[model samples]
Target: MKHYLPQVRFWKIISIILALTGVLFTLIGIFCTEGALAVHWGSDGTPNGFAGKIVLVLIALMGVLSMFSGESFRKERPGWHIPVGPEMGYALSTGLTGCCAGVNVIVVLYYFRPDERIPAVGAIAIIVLYLMFIMIAFYRDRRYNGRDVKTGEESHR
Candidate 1:
């Protein structure tokens, strides 16, 4: 068990980092309605700065939520399965990300064409992809099993 402690701790650290990034992105979106939208970077010519920021924030939140859910699965057996909240969050976040990625792929392919919705059609896709990656991280964590110290039981985390 002692040998696994360091490995478990490492996973916890990863979860913390993911959570922090998600919180940061969500906070960025929350504050973006203010003057944050008007600012411009180099000539990135990206989507509307404000909207993009908000999307990123949403993606981050999705990541954080998914991580929490996955971590829940790894917790002691008393509450590990996460039949509702965490499982739902993980599933939704991943699905959203996949959908967004699909949209972005289409948008990028047809970017040269002039269409009314062309510019922003794929914006959500970027956020979706970001969210999906986070979800995947959570999925991996959930899939990995770890020991429960108190019970000495071969529980899955």
Candidate 2:
């Protein structure tokens, strides 16, 4: 292993965040009353303020996933359970986040009156950041991961 590999341990921490956020989004859909507020409903839409909490939780989770994916991309070889590239893993984690964010935004706007402000700017920002993180992670993974050109297969180096 390269000395730099250990330096990226922080990235794994990030990945777990993404995975857990997916779990949170699933939970919110089931338990929260303010599913509509995800779009930005002020008060009238859904009785539950839980949607906001879920969104916040989701944002944190995605951010963590992005970081961890990047770390693993550099560190993980073609092991038993893992394939190659951070794309598949990162996408799986963040896709749910993006979907939930989209759904929340839509439902919030559709049901709630405009006069009521739920504030979706934070959610939008979170999505953008998470996406950016994934991009960076994938780029790094591409450089460090995958098969070596010499043998056209995974390289231990």
Candidate 3:
């Protein structure tokens, strides 16, 4: 556990930063935009659906919740079990908050400049990056936790 402390702390800090970024983007979108923001885009690269500015508030709330959830991974509690380990939890939580931040930024950009075509590939890239983070965390946890990957039994070491 002590050996993994630094890694856990690093992820926690990242999660905090991403959450704060999300909140900032949400604020910018809410106050800066003049009308209903486009929350969804069609396959033709046009915004076919709209949402009230209040939706930004929900995004901000998700950011706050992600921050708290990531912080929970700071320490291991007795009798509490995280199947994928705390490291993975931290990574996933941070990644999710990061995605929210990214989306917030995109929406804000779209509001400011509706003429530009924002490629959906960016969203796909974010998802891939997030999955990579989880895989890295899972492998790292397995390496340090002294447990067999297949049997789930603790190794003597």
Q: What TM-score fits each model?
A: 0.30, 0.34, 0.72
lDDT of each: 0.43, 0.47, 0.73
**Model 1: per-residue lDDT, tens digit, 55-98?**
54555555544443433343556645544334333444344434
* Better candidate by TM-score, 1 or 2: 2
**Residue pairs in clash, model 1:** 25-57, 74-157, 97-128, 100-125
- Which 10-residue window in model 3 sums to the lowest lDDT? 1-10
How many clashes (backbone N, Cα, C below 3 Å) per candidate? Answer: 4, 11, 0
- Model 2 lDDT, residue 113, Cα: 42
Q: How far is each candidate from the true structure, as Cα RMSD in Å?
A: 11.6, 10.0, 5.8
What's the lDDT of the predicted structure labeled candidate 1?
0.43
Relative to the unseen true structure, what is the C-alpha lDDT of residue 115 in candidate 2, on a scale of 0 to 100?
35
Residue 57, candidate 2: alpha-carbon lDDT: 50
Candidate 3 displacement at residue 79 in angstroms: 18
The weakest ten consecutive residues by lDDT in model 1 span 1-10
